[model samples]
Target: MLKIVKTEILKLKRYHILWAGIALMLLSVMLTLFTSMANDGSVWDFTYMIEQVIKNNMSTIFPMCITLITGYIITREQKDNTLKNILTIPISFKQLLVGKLLVCGILSLFLGMICTIFTIMGSFLAGFPGFSVGLALQAFIQITFVNLFLYIAVMPIVILTSRFSSGFLIGVIVAFVYGYCGMFAAGDMKLANLVSVKK
Candidate 1:
């Protein structure tokens, strides 16, 4: 499994889809910055900025973004005609799938860090008040863990899509709707609890 994960990482070294994922991560921060321009007179600070970024992550960006990327990775074996070669090496597709899932968990953490960096940069650029080392550290930990949990939430979709060729495209659509629903759920405690367990 470790070897499979390492090989998957190596394959991703040149994978252009990663750039798309990074761009999506950047889009979350960009959206947060754009929201900061509102004249509603609400005070904006580092902590609030981090909160909004995490909100956007959960409500808009991370779930679908990670799902899309994970789906691509899972289906690539079929897309590139490499499954046969991979299977010939004495590994079952089930094992390969598990390895791919593990790789995605790790990838989610790395992307989380990237998102944190972008959030901090966005905060600085937007002139958010009350910046502090403690807040930054808190943001880092929160965003990174939130990403991992979000990835976990979307894992079933990735696994389902992996069973079909190019099914990840469908997973992307499902993930977007799935994530968007969270915004509505958060408004009601009952709905939020139901949705939390549903995921």
Candidate 2:
């Protein structure tokens, strides 16, 4: 299983999928930066900016981004017809899929960190005050852990969608809408807690 996971991670090397994830991760920061043009009368602080990044992530970008990347990586085996060779090594499709899922969990946290860095960049570039080491760590935890949990929420979609031929593109659309719905589920702490995987 460890070898399988390692192999799965190695396949991501030189792959453009992670590059896309990085760009998408930066996207939330860009969106928040754009919103600053409106002057909504809300003070922009480090925490506030990080909150915006998380809000945008839950609503628009991260879930779909991860899904698309995971989907592509999984589909590559089928598209390239490497399943037979993989099976020759006696690895079942279930084991392979599980390995990909684990790797994606790691990837989600990685993208979360990328998002946090850009959140700081967005805050400073926008001239938001109240930056501090503690705030940075909080933002990192909030964004990274939330993302990892959100990945759990979307994993079934990613897995199911990846199984079909050319379904990943479709998965992106579905995952986006699915993730966006989480915003609506934001009424109560108990309900919002459902949004967290730690529950």
The candidate that achieves the highest TM-score relative to the unseen native structure: 1
**Superposed Cα deviation of residue 182, candidate 1 (Å):** 0.2
Q: What digit string (tens of lDDT, one per residue) describes model 1 on residues 36-92? A: 889999789999999998999998899899999899998999989999999999999
Query: Per-model C-alpha lDDT, please?
Result: 0.89, 0.86
The local distance difference test score of model 1 is: 0.89
Clashes of each: 0, 0
lDDT of 2 by residue, 2-106 (tens): 998998888899578799999998888999888877867988788888888888898889889988998988888998898888888877899999999999999
Location of the lowest summed lDDT over 10 successive residues in candidate 1: 190-199
The number of residue pairs in model 2 that clash at the backbone is: 0
Model 2, residue 101: distance off in Å is 0.6
